[model samples]
Target: MTAWIILPVSLSTFSITGIWIVYAMAVMNHHVCPVENWVYNDSCSDDTAKHGYPKSCCTLNDVPLISKCGTYPPESCLFSLIGNLGAFMVVLICVLRYSQVLEQSHRSWVNTTALIAGCTNAAGLIIVGNFQVDYAKSLHYIGAGVAFPAGLLFVCLQCVLTYHIAATTLDLWMAHVRVTLSALALISLVFSGIFFIHDSFLLQHLAAVCEWIFVIDILIFYGTFAYEFGGISRDTIVTAIQHASSRACKSPGSSSTSTHLHCNPEGITMI
Candidate 1:
């Protein structure tokens, strides 16, 4: 079995990939088929038979997600092949590299929760990667599952848990630092939450806010990873992170830090 860290990171990476696929399809003037119809274009579209209720034609809702996605055609798959494969490979690489660290790292409820979220996401990817992908498009059914944990539950936990982790540990400075940082991470979480509730990414489809939520969650995620790694890997994090395909975080970005976990040498910034 893979280590605990692998699970959360996998969830994050996979969810990000799902988002990327959707974003790409949208940009290409394609849309994910909500219904599941795979016949390219609106050619095979059958409205009366699709939804229980009959419609003029298969609007996006009528088309099957198994096949239809947005407005694009099957050729979109040829375009997204490279990016899709690469994202999966990256997920594999991250787990392999951190396998050792996860073995001996401290276990926490937050970590467990993140794992659960990741597994759910992985299941979704399996669908997108295997049966349903039209080039790079994903159903987001998987992405939403993963996002619930990292973007919602886990990010919140990082605050209280980081504070608790900090306060209880031998290092007073680190504890205080965690307390402050975790507190601040709450802010990002708030905006991210609002975006999702409204289905807007601070723009259209506020739900797309999920992209940044995970991005911010990663900072805190990295911090937790650092704590799990014990000594921390200054090198692994310093590199520029592309994040998920949908949206990329800024360079030299810090993962989510709670408002509470502030100060100390190993501050949230380090994450």
Candidate 2:
């Protein structure tokens, strides 16, 4: 079997490719201009949809956000599919990461908090995917609001954890990489938000660019986990579960008589 390292790689690959595919579809259908033109054009008009096949077009006054790229037909279905599957992958990766960290380093509040933030980020992704920005503006914004900040927090926490538990030179180097990526992600996120709210078309375009940069940065950070995750195997998950079950069996409320049924002599639990 392949190492669990594939999980993070798959998540990053599919998500980045999928979003770009949606953007391509939008461009092909005349729903939005090519990203290069959209960002650099001084003037844009929403009239393409009238001359073309699409029902809507992203004009200069309305910069195409990533979410906006999938608001229309065809691409919308792909977008939702990517969002839901990506969210599932994110959750899985988060769980595996938490388990790995707990085993390598002693459990701490940082690890626990990272897990929570990751889950929140995943939930936000699901919402963003299912709710198209044009159709459900409020809900879409809510999801973005939750996902972006939570994602930043998750990466920052993971960087700190990497530095805290780093033992080898490779681990220390990984910490440095993560710290740099986290800083860039933070800067992109802040500018994306700040520029998005402005009235100027160029500023809005810049915001869209920043949003893409932020997302790409996050995906790259996730990809970095593949190196560490290369060590994870089926036994890793089994061991983590066994540890949890044994801890539960030893809780104060559990009786010795029930303990034998819940846990084996080797401390492995049947359940």
Clash count, one per candidate: 59, 0
lDDT (0 to 1) per candidate = 0.39, 0.84
Please report the candidate that would top lDDT against the real structure. Answer: 2
User: What is the per-residue lDDT of model 2 for residues 1-271, given as tens digits with 9 covering 90 to 100?
Assistant: 4568788999899999999999888878766666676434444354543423453444553356799888888999999999899989989988888888877875688998999999999999999999999899999999999999999999999999999889899999999999999999999999999998887767888888999999989988988889789887665676568667767879998888998776773645333
Which 10 consecutive residues of model 2 have the lowest summed lDDT?
48-57
Candidate 2 — which pairs collide? Answer: none
Top of the candidates by TM-score: 2
How does candidate 1 score on lDDT? 0.39
User: Distance (Å) between predicted and true CA of 190, model 1?
Assistant: 8.9
TM values, all candidates: 0.36, 0.86
Off by over 4 Å in 2: 38-62, 246-271
